[model samples]
Target: MPTETEREESWLTRDELEDVRGRVPMLYVIAVPVRVGEAGDLDQVGLLLRASDTGRMERELVAGRVLYHERIRDALVRHLEKDLGPMALPRIPVSPQPLTVAEFFPTPGVTPYHDPRQHAVALVFAVPVHGDCAPQQDALELAWLTPSEAASTDVEAEMAGGHAVLLRQVLAHLGQTL
Candidate 1:
């Protein structure tokens, strides 16, 4: 087994990450936690309330980069649990596939999505969660909003980094027109 230090090396150091960010597009998993109503219909979407690196509060989906040796499904579960707490009970697929691939550009207007830090290609998954989700890490709250409420202009305005666009994509994948 790898030692603790070896395990820690699975993550990129700050300088290493910045150097790589300038060279290539990073792969990330964007997990959108959702709820299924009793009738087997989509109930709500979970959005995290947190402060961005700039100290402005924003709503966001659970997201993170996939480690060098990590599986995509594992990356999804890790980010979901880290942001939504251990009891979030995210439903991960045995054979995972993304609902869509969202490409984020460093330049604005390049796409509907923008990420000023680095160009990233993200695999988007709609994870149906069943258990209680107390916000974890930097998350201040987990808001479960109906599809309509989530797609509202007001809610979209509160989300930076084009997360609202991603949410809309997930909603459309789930058969919600909005």
Candidate 2:
């Protein structure tokens, strides 16, 4: 019998993952965590600053691939903790429905989202997070910005891979205007 780690390891190697990416669209979940005020209005938006493939700094949301047979909720929790640290205490939504969907095509201009590595379909959520958030893994830092700051031209220009569009969509979904 294989352990959970063993089972995960047996799922796919690097070459196999590339092959699968080429053959099918990968599943992804993206989280836009926010802080709410006492009146239930949005307070701050969280964004991660990370190094991209080109070694340039870029802003991004909390995102990760959903493993085979894994539940979406579990994947969301895993990715939230992976990027936001354990003490971040993300408030997972009661409903499984996403705020929006972002389809990333390999070719640029096909959509608002683009992923040069693979074609990915991401279910995006606007998560309300309590507790302090610390950047984890390869993330350089986490920036907490006001709705206006997040939608600012400087901030939008700093984001790569269409995350700016996604951020705008998230803000709009949250009833915040740029």
TM-score of each: 0.93, 0.93
RMSD of each predicted structure: 3.3, 3.0
Tens-place lDDT per residue, model 2, 1-178, is 8776665434788999999999899999999989999999999999999988889888999999999888898889899899999988888865678989999999999998999989999999988889888999999999999999999999998898899999999999899976
- Candidate 2 — which residues are off by over 4 angstroms? 1-11
Q: Give the TM-score of candidate 2.
A: 0.93
lDDT of 1 by residue, 1-178 (tens): 8876675445678999999999999999999999999988999999999998989989999999998988999999889999999999988989888999999999999888899999999999999999999999989999999999999999999998789988998999899986
The positional error of residue 79 in candidate 1, measured at the CA in angstroms, is 0.3
For model 2 the local lDDT of residue 3 reads 78
Candidate 1's C-alpha runs over 4 A off are 1-9
Q: How many backbone clashes does candidate 2 have?
A: 0
